[model samples]
Target: MTVTPRTALTIAGSDSGGGAGVQADLRTFFANGVHGLVALTAVTVQNSLGVQGFSEIPVDVVTAQIKAVAEDMGVDAAKTGMLATAEIIQSVAKTLDEVHIGRTTDTPFVVDPVAASMTGHALLREEALEAIRTELFPRATLITPNLDEVRLLTGVSVTDAASQRTAAEALLEFGSQWVLVKGGHLCDTADCVDLLTDGSAIIELSGPRIDTENTHGGGDTMASAITSSLAKGADVPTAVAEAKRFIERCVMEAYPLGAGVGPVSPFWRLANPR
Candidate 1:
């Protein structure tokens, strides 16, 4: 059989820590057998400990990168994370709109609304939230938001599976085709649970929560892993299911790498497969 490798792209930031953002997405893509590509939107001086400083890529430069990638290398599926400003969000949203208008019809646009850090520090500008929800989110094939980002977008503080359901519906009305509400941030339980909804059906994925603090890039990892599956022709529900399994395995084998919280191992499948 003559076949080309599946390709996926990520429009996000650079993590100097080599754990989250661009680094994490590319790593997850490669591990999942998808060729990875990127259009960086920002640079962050960060370590496993925290982000010390950050700089947004100019809107023109960000626009150029996305155009360059899509024009040539092309994308079968794509995801976005950590757009630091409103301008960057608008640019990414518009570019993807154009990409879908032509050859990439079934390509899934996975948006990971990374509004805040695990420690409650804001990673995105407050002004950018409106751009993400209004400009980019409605165009998304699947929107993955952790509980914190869900509250920021929906104003519904999700504390359990029941509240998670409410938050998903509120997000749906905003126009995304599907919503995957990651419940990793919920403090009420020892088991990690995530909810995926597409108006009519609600799918719940649960696993015994591995006790670990090295989970900094969990949201980005989850979204990109799903994008990788979509690039390889998995349906939305199947992609979500496989990505959930991937993230859980990554967490299971995750080791502490730096002085502070480490990141989940996106390439954990090499050592252990489920």
Candidate 2:
């Protein structure tokens, strides 16, 4: 007569402002009806204005945290964000293999490929970029990259539909099972169009672009929503579609917080009553 709640893990940094990173992921997980777990990679001193300073958790500590939660609680799905260095990324990939939580395994693992803060402060080191391509991407069930991250990862500037397709293909070459080239940063379009592909089947998630500067944590919210849906037994396409809808509503409900930029509110779920 006991029902077990679905669970998802976020192997990410901590946002002191509580609008992004594991904070946003946890909120998104809760909103999507899943238990959330975390393996914090770094701690950032940041606010609505921007990131000021940060500290990366030691690689061993990072891996150990992942191992502890994944082995004990059992992760149905997991996602990574703001991995600060090449050493950490490599160690994380190795630990993921040890824990059997990767694309090659049964569990879905999302790679957010976070390189910098939304305000353009670097969250990851320059050297870690290559490690993400060589190590983590290959282990990913899906890679969700904003237009800026797409350019940083693939050196392909995604401007329109054609470029989005190109960027997705480029990401696929790194061996991820699927790629989501997020077009939220593409201002030319009336609707914010995100291109999802697996080197063949292409699906476009298009929604009315909500005009708001308070889009902090937008990407993390979408990624965690996908992970949460995956934990609830949804397929990748279904999970992403549901996440797209979830995030669009979150953006629509976003409210101004600090002086600079506010966060996209996940509280929309409460008002909408699930």
Best by TM-score: 2
Sliding window of 10 residues with minimal summed lDDT for model 2: 265-274
Pairs clashing within candidate 2: none
Q: TM-score per candidate, in order?
A: 0.95, 0.98
lDDT of 1 by residue, 1-274 (tens): 9777889989899989888899999989988988998889889889877888789989888878877878888788888898999988887778787777212367778889888667565679989999988987788889999887888898999987889999999999988889999988886698889999999999998988888888978888999999999999898899999999899988877779889888899877766554
Worst lDDT 10-window in candidate 1: 98-107
lDDT of 2 by residue, 1-274 (tens): 9777898999999999999999999999988779999899999999999999999999999999988888889999999989999999999999999999998898999999999998999999999999999999999999999988899888999878998998899889999999999999999899999989887789999999998888999999999999999998899999999999999999998889889889999989977884
Q: What overall lDDT goes with each candidate model?
A: 0.86, 0.93
Where in model 1 is the C-alpha error above 4 Å?
Answer: 1-3, 101-104, 272-274
Residue clash pairs of candidate 1 = none
Error of 2 at 1 (Å): 4.6
